[model samples]
Target: MEEYFSAVRKMEQTVMFPSLLQGVSLGDLANTLDSSSNEKDLYESYTLLKSIKTMVEDGLVPLNQTFPVATQMKEQEIKEEEDLESLFYYHVSSLYRILTRLTRRAKAVTSKYDEIMGQMNQNEKRLSF
Candidate 1:
């Protein structure tokens, strides 16, 4: 999980996110144009991934009523065996699942960004030559 998160963060820092986004504008990443283009969705997920992690790190869960992830997680956890250890395991498993999904999503967004960057590079090379 950390591996995936680290990999995605590295990619985002190095290439996935550029100041100019090459030829892709901020608008391109903000709104869905068509089904063939998913830049908007990817960027949304990218921001969401970061936002969720930051919220967790900042102690926004359990007390912060505005955190949707916490609310959703609470609703999803199994409501069986109201013992301390059982509840502990349930929370642990739920957190593990959420982290895994978020990290994998970050990696997928990175992959899509890499593909976009590659295409931009190819276009640049063609124009330069």
Candidate 2:
């Protein structure tokens, strides 16, 4: 289980996230702030974060069943079990924090988009002379 958590953490930090954010330039964000393009980017980002959360949870399901087995192990094995438990919890907490932040960012993006659309509608009404 420790190995599995370690492998997932490594992939998330070193490969998955970096690849996902690779081409997202600051110019893209600035220019498309309230446009469909920005919404598309935010949706993709949210989806990727959701996928990562699911992967971590799926990996943890099997580990959840090993707690009873850990209690029955010998001294050295018991210590290893404790270590694995801590590692697993640490990954879970980290992923939770990341997901929370991602959720907040998505909300902010949506709000900004709505605000821009509202302003555009008001402008259009005033210009309908």
Best by lDDT: 1
The deviation in Å at residue 72 for candidate 1 is 9.5
lDDT of 1 at 44: 63
Residue 13, model 2: lDDT of 44
Give the worst 10-residue stretch by lDDT in candidate 1: 29-38
Report model 1's TM-score to 2 decimal places: 0.64
Model 1: residues with Cα > 4 Å off, grouped in runs: 4-8, 15-40, 62-82
TM-score of each: 0.64, 0.41
Residue pairs clashing in model 2 are none
Candidate 1, 1-129: lDDT as tens digits:
566468556656755364333344334433322234334455566666677666665764456555676567666554544676988886789888767766666666566577787888999999999
Displacement of the residue 102 alpha carbon in candidate 2, Å: 0.9
lDDT string for model 2 (8-60, tens) is 34434433333344344324455433342343454455445447557666665
Clash count per candidate: 0, 0
Off by over 4 Å in 2: 1-82
lDDT score, residue 4, model 2? 37
